[model samples]
Target: MASHIVQNPSAGCIVKFMQGNEPQIAWVMEEQKGKLRLFLPNRRETTLSPSRILPWAGPSYPATQSKDAVVELLNRHRERRERLASEVAPMELWEMAQGEMERAPAEWFAELGYTSPDADAVAACGRALLQCKTHFRFQPPEFEIYDAATVESRRQAEEAARVREAMVCGGADWFRRLWEARIGRHPAPDASTAPEEPVRGRLEKMLRARMRDPETVEDEALWKQVTKGLPDDPHLALLLAMTWGLVPEHYNFWLDRADYESGTAWEEPLESETQELIRAVEEGGSLPPAEDTVFISIDSATTRDIDDAFCIASAADGGWDVEVALACPAWFWNFDSALGKAVFHRATSIYLPEGNCHMMPEALGEGAFSLFEGQARPALVVGAHVAPDGTLGEGSFRFSTIKVAKNLNYPDCEAALDGVENAASPFVESLRLAAAMSDRRLASRVEHGAVIIERPEIDFELEGEGADITVKLRPYPAAPRAQLLVAELMVVANAVLAEWAVKNDVPLLFRTQDVAVPREYAGVWKSAPDIARVVRILVAASLDVVPRPHAGMGLSAYSPVTSPLRRFTDLVNEAQLLSVLTRGSVRWSREELSDMLMHLSIRLEAAGQVQRFRPRYWKYLYIQQQARAHGDECCWKAEVAEENDMWVSVSLPEVQLGLRGKRSLFGEKVFPGQELHVRLGKVNPLRNEAVILDVREC
Candidate 1:
């Protein structure tokens, strides 16, 4: 059928055929039906079909001609055709024939370039068209011309392909050399060994981007091609980025993973809002009324965003009237504005060993909205009368401008409670009253099935920056004196405010823990073993628009409206409460608030991961440093929380770290509440792994 379709060449006729990418000249020595016996240029004989012949064929030769003569003729023809192909400018020919016709034979193109073109001229035209793929597409008998737009696009793509090929050949090897140089596997490479200009810059950018977010990398196919021969390591991009000096050692990739922006750069777009807030704070007198409550705030010494404060006074019925003043950015914050959206994306402030990532701009959170001592600031103040029996009476919520009388740190307050003169001495009597009320409240909550764990805070101090950084972990007071007062009063304010919301039927994001706990699990727990035992059976709190009982707090309902400057949920709740107090209606309906919370839940989960893991990352780094400095001689105190045949879970109360090891390392009688000292081995901070080398019972 192919013989019927294709015309067979006569014997001894020189023809052109394709051998891979190059064209070859061959003489037909014999013909049989569709088959032809041909002699190649190298004096080799082969049989081929007539359909295999290229479009162009040459003049015939004598069958009895010498082999040398035929070979010489073939070489001469090959040289002539190649030279003609070189002389034909593909672009010039494309310009000449582009608008002339949609498609044309090679002979026609040769005729357009020459008067009465020969077979060599036609074949050269075909060869040139095949080589110039951007302007023309070859299809056997004819070549198709591309339009101007398509030709330009294809030309650019062809150029990019060439560059990519060049990068893969040279850039990959260059990166390998740099990586080897970084690890001391090879000598450092010189500047001359780097890839040229655009490739070097582009490669560095790509590596950085991949290191930031590896899963969503652009040009992933090209990345695979370029990194084909590199080690199949998950942290390859990070390693390469470090080697290229794009990032420093121990870079925070978790921030990149969550797409959480660091620093005040995110506050640039809200400059106008920030300035407006500052002006509002400076102007003063825009609130509902001014309160003469002389509230005092108790927080860590490093705290700048003072959101909540409280003051106590004796009521007529021998009860303490407690008033709480919370920083109110809700009065000026526009929830529909860009700043609000950014704040919502952050969800909550993250306190890490490195620094605090505030939810709101510092201009507003720390300066304007914070309840700074002696400064008149807008506040959402809640007042409730706590009876001598610790029963809370009717509460009131109002928007007021208040000034904090003192800003006391925990240690100074504790010393003041012990009758040591300090800045907190003026409030010593009031602190005693608050502590007495805290004791009664703790007794009342425990009677109602509350489980309170008073865990000491671990202060992480960093001495340096980057790779040479050192960390020191110091445990704050285990049985806190002043912290208990602040915690109980804050919990009372939230519970009363939540109760008020229920009566008013206003929607707030209430924290609900609707689980039943055994009455035996109710008292305060201070030891690590005691805290861990009670915590194992407890469920985490959940958020909802409807009011429900919070089992852990032992309250009828609880809503977080204390930290408006640090948490988005508290700001929203404050806004709702302010609206109900002013206009007698809620700002957001139940359904609308629920829908908004769905989006916030995702961001909160991401923020929680960063908050929960980033500090542990630093703690692991500290442990590794300690292990290296003292080897097996360094020991850490651990309390066994759980034990099984396979593994033992222990809690290190000093650093607030938890670890698990094989049961065999803890001897035959490892049980809960058992104290031991462990030596860490095989510590890898990046992977969050620290193995226990040896353990000894204390």
Candidate 2:
């Protein structure tokens, strides 16, 4: 009895017809050459033979003869999957099935290439083969046997893929909409549902109080008191802001807006400078006289448009002579033209994901009035020379039409310095000497006190297969070698400009950066860098040499003149330079320049919003993959890469494993990061989610 009950080594089967139950597919596994054999469950079993299993039963099959009319059918089918699944199989099962099919190959003549079936025909045949074990199927007489099933399966698979892609696409759209709606730039579905309330509290009063004061023109009396007949311009304001000086955005907002409006006044407050601006540009377009003086660097190897140039030569009494020239374009695109109005509405150029947004059309921006090519253009030049050690010497401003050799980007010049050739220009040599002198001067100012910070500049990759954004840090070797050279001239020029303004009492923009206040970051202060350190951060950004520290660079004083291609304030600085040198006057009022400072500050802040979102989302996806690929088998270890008020950063040691291309799931699994794990845990690649199970301190 024990021997008989030993659970027959195999389920020896006999076919029986059942009344209700669906036909059970059982493979007829029999002992053959001491190994198990599997026969097709779809056909009937008969006399056993070494060959001639499935006969050429299909009408489409080749005309071949076989010894047996009957074939073996599987007794108890192990399992069955979807037709498409079986046909496509997984990538791993090709050898076994193909091996079987190759031997005594199917008794059918597969069609030749000259007359080919369409994709649908191929898919239908493939499905039929999976369902009918012998790769033979009963097709409607209306269709070819192979063509029908092959075509059908393919259609089904395609439809499934289409659905999957739609699901993914729809889901992404939903989330993006949700995020945008929350930010309030646009209203969402529920946005308008709120009941309209009666005019209630004084909303305007509060809003007005919060908004910065507007003005038409800068206060002339106040400005002249400060500038002293020199120019008060945009560069000065930007530098002042950099040095922690406060400038409100609303101050300049209304002034720019006034140009497009008619003599009819909008409710917005604007300074007196705004009136000057509207009158100046209300004509066809702003264009200065071409025959006028131009700024040039005639020796650059590969550039067009000489926007600005500087000159440094030995002065009498063993002093140095220096001069800085800047391009001007506001004279062209006046307030009346549609193009100019569009630029005014945009407020300034926009840097975005797809491409750049220029405030002014290229017709003016890179053309006509542009400091492009060998064409002599108008310019406001500021020339100054310090002693051999950078002590402020003789300085003056003038109008000039200088020529430029060629254009060079930052990298081009850096390369030249590294011996890449053609980057250096004879015209730029004098500036280098001036830069050395300026560096020495600024060094001394730092000794007095100024702030300096080293931040990793950021950039991004717009397109790649992944959903998340990634950025590669540009190497420092890319920093332009001409930086200090040009900077010295600009700074001295700016210093002279500012000093002239103060002495002559003119209104102009002044840049400033504030020291970090302890109360603002008190939450973080409670844990990390105490109040003292925070103060250090502020001080490090504020040491000014000529009282205009622009301390963020740890300089007593500094000014920006490079890359006017993108900055509006720099152009404004050029405007101030023009007023001072050419007219011996000041144009924009302190209120107007101050107002622009406010607008730019806001613009800078808004740009940051777009940048931060992409990277954070990408990081989330990467972490999901990290958790999925590694299980809770061991407590994972990682190093601290960053830490802040809310979270600590970590870096894991190397381990070899596939991260399963983003958001793909394998067997059922849990997500990672569910818990604050010092340990290993579950990961879900499908949804880019993670759950931390256990954590071990690293």
- Using lDDT as the measure, which candidate wins? 1
Give the range of the ten consecutive residues with the poorest summed lDDT in model 2: 1-10
Give candidate 1's whole-model lDDT.
Answer: 0.84
Off by over 4 Å in 1: 1-14, 59-65, 148-184, 187-234, 285-287, 477-479
* TM-score of each candidate structure, all chains considered together: 0.91, 0.43
lDDT of each: 0.84, 0.39
**Compared with the true structure, what per-residue lDDT tens digits does model 1 show for residues 214-314?**
77559788788778877776667887776666677777766766668888999999999889879978898576578788899999988999999998988
Tally clashing residue pairs in candidate 2. Answer: 126
In candidate 2, which residue ranges exceed 4 Å CA deviation? 1-307, 314-320, 333-341, 344-354, 393-395, 418-420, 423-435, 456-460, 464-477, 514-536, 539-549, 553-565, 580-585, 592-604, 607-698
Error of 2 at 365 (Å): 2.6
lDDT of 2 by residue, 446-541 (tens): 443433322223332344432233322222333533655555556677667656655666555545454433333322221112322444556433
What's the C-alpha lDDT at position 354 in model 2? 28
